[model samples]
Target: MNVRGVIAGLLFLPITILLSIAVCLARPFSRLAWPSKVMQLWANSVFWMSGIKLQVVGEEHLTAGKPAIYMANHASMIDIPILVAVLPGHVRFLFKHTLMYVPFLGQAMMLLGMIPINRTNRTKSVESLRKAGERIRSGIDVIIFPEGTRTKTGEMLPFKNGGFLMAIQEGFDIVPVTIHNSREVCGRNSIVTRKGVCRVTIHPRYETTGFTVADRRQIMSDVERIIGSAVQLRGRDNAAPVIELGHH
Candidate 1:
């Protein structure tokens, strides 16, 4: 890991936490509106400070006032911020169970109603998915990195079935999100940074209306194929409008 990268990350941690707190406190009254704007502010700041540029495409596929499961490929630390900043609606995150215990950040996450699932334990994982499915039924959009962890190489990893299983069981639509070049910019295993362009392609959504638990593997494979093809098509397309993040 780069010493400068570590120091830079540490310097930004407090500001990020403060932003999280502010969003949490304002969430009750503003609901998704204020919180979503604040989140974009923080995300944009992180990317700008890191000297990364964002190009997000296919946002028109996202239907306003509708809930869908956004299953994105995980490759770098910046992927979360890119998605949070670019996605049109208010989206909740599915975090690891252990993250729920992290200091003030954890409390703020709870206030935001982020879902945490224990992947190592079957019973707990199922229960967590059930809760998440209920939230989807209630019209809350949730973002899940189906890969479960980041890929060392930029290539997509085999996705875990948990998120697909939940989407199928709840009959929610699955949005296949492909993130291109983020791993090259800031890899998950290393904090070392590079100034480069990263793109997020939101592919057409897959409906799970008639899917069952038995179709989990198939559903996962279909989404993977869609994202993989899209990722391969990434380029410096000046035609696609870049999502601009305002200074915090």
Candidate 2:
């Protein structure tokens, strides 16, 4: 474990939590403007303290004032903060239900109107997505990591159908987002953070207007392929060639 990183994270956690509470209290119930700005600050602070360098690409693909579901690949716990730092405009996450009980952080997240999915219960999951759809219709953008959990091996995981199907059912477009080398910074199930550049690539949005519920599998595959290929390309590009120096 990176003791210094753990210490840094511990020192910053409460500050961000307090900032979150203060911002939420000021905004009151998901007012995107002030809250989004606060989140941006918080994300930036966390990344700075953790020494995580973020390199964002393809942000031009995102259109202003267009509500879309951002489907991203998950590899690290820090992915949320990285997205918060890089993604433009207002955005909320489709997070797991258990995170809703996390003390002050939970209250802040609720105030931000983050949707929680109960994967174990079909009924609740559907209801959650229904609410998410309503939010998207209301012009709030939502981000979902369809991988459902962080990848342990830094390779793409098979995506769950829930998020993609929800986008299709609600007629929301899907933005395929590829987050490269996140695991090198902070891997799944580990809190030790390393200093490195985390690359975020935002692909053009995929419209779901023509897709039916039956197309969920294909939709998932397409998104996975896009993200996986981008990640692989980035890995290859980042791989350093070994050079040997002869004695002079």
Candidate 3:
């Protein structure tokens, strides 16, 4: 672990927590139009503190006020902040149910309208996803990690069907996103940070309104291919070696 990275973490961690508390307190009366702004401020702080930088491509692909399912491959914990910081629109994240019980932050998450799923129980997971879809239909865009969990190796994982299913059921478009170099910066299961650049590419939306249950597998497969191709292209363009850094 880099000693400077450690120092940066120590310095930024408390400030992040304090900001989270402030955001939590503001969640009760009205929607935090600036939640993403707060998140961007935090992400920029973390980046500056850790000596990491972000280069985003395809900003023109994102349309304002349009609710679409933003699906991305998970590489590192940093992915969340990066997405929250760069992705436009109000994003309601679909996270594990366990996150909803994490002290003060959890209460704030609930108030902010994050959907939590009990993945252990299939029935409950589906129900939770349905509710999430409803929220999307009601005007909030949802961000989901179709890979379901972070990859330790940085390789793309087999995307779960849940995200696509919700898109099909709710008549929403799927915006495939590829995040590059996060694993190299901060690999899964390690706290150490490496100086590097993380790139996020937002592909144009793939419509799902006409798809049916029989097309579920195909939809997921297509999403996987889109992400894989985007990642590969970014690596080639950046002159980085192509390796599956995601954990199996």
Model 3 misplaced stretches (Cα beyond 4 Å): 1-4, 11-13, 99-112, 234-248
Q: Write the per-residue lDDT of candidate 2 for residues 1-248, one digit (tens) a residue.
A: 55646765676558657777767577755466787877777777666666667666786888878889998999887888888877788888998888789776677677666888999999999998989888788777889999887887788788889988888877888999998888888868565687777778889988889999999888888888988878866554333321111110
- Candidates in order: C-alpha RMSD to true structure: 2.9, 6.5, 5.4
Cα displacement (angstroms), candidate 3, residue 115, comes to 2.3
lDDT (C-alpha) at residue 30 in model 1 = 79
Best by TM-score: 2
**Of 1 and 3, which scores higher on TM-score?**
1
Q: Which regions of candidate 2 fall more than 4 Å away from where they truly are?
A: 1-4, 235-248
lDDT for position 235 in model 3: 47
- Return the number of clashes found in candidate 1: 0
Candidate 3 per-residue C-alpha lDDT over 1-248 given as tens digits, one digit per residue, 9 for 90 to 100: 56655666565546566767766676664464656556656666666667766767777889877789999988886777678767766787887788677655466556556788887899999998988878777777889998888886667877888888888877789999999888888767444577777888888889988899789999998889988887755544454322212110
Question: Cα lDDT of all candidates, in order?
Answer: 0.78, 0.78, 0.75
As a whole number from 0 to 100, the lDDT of residue 228 in candidate 1 is 89
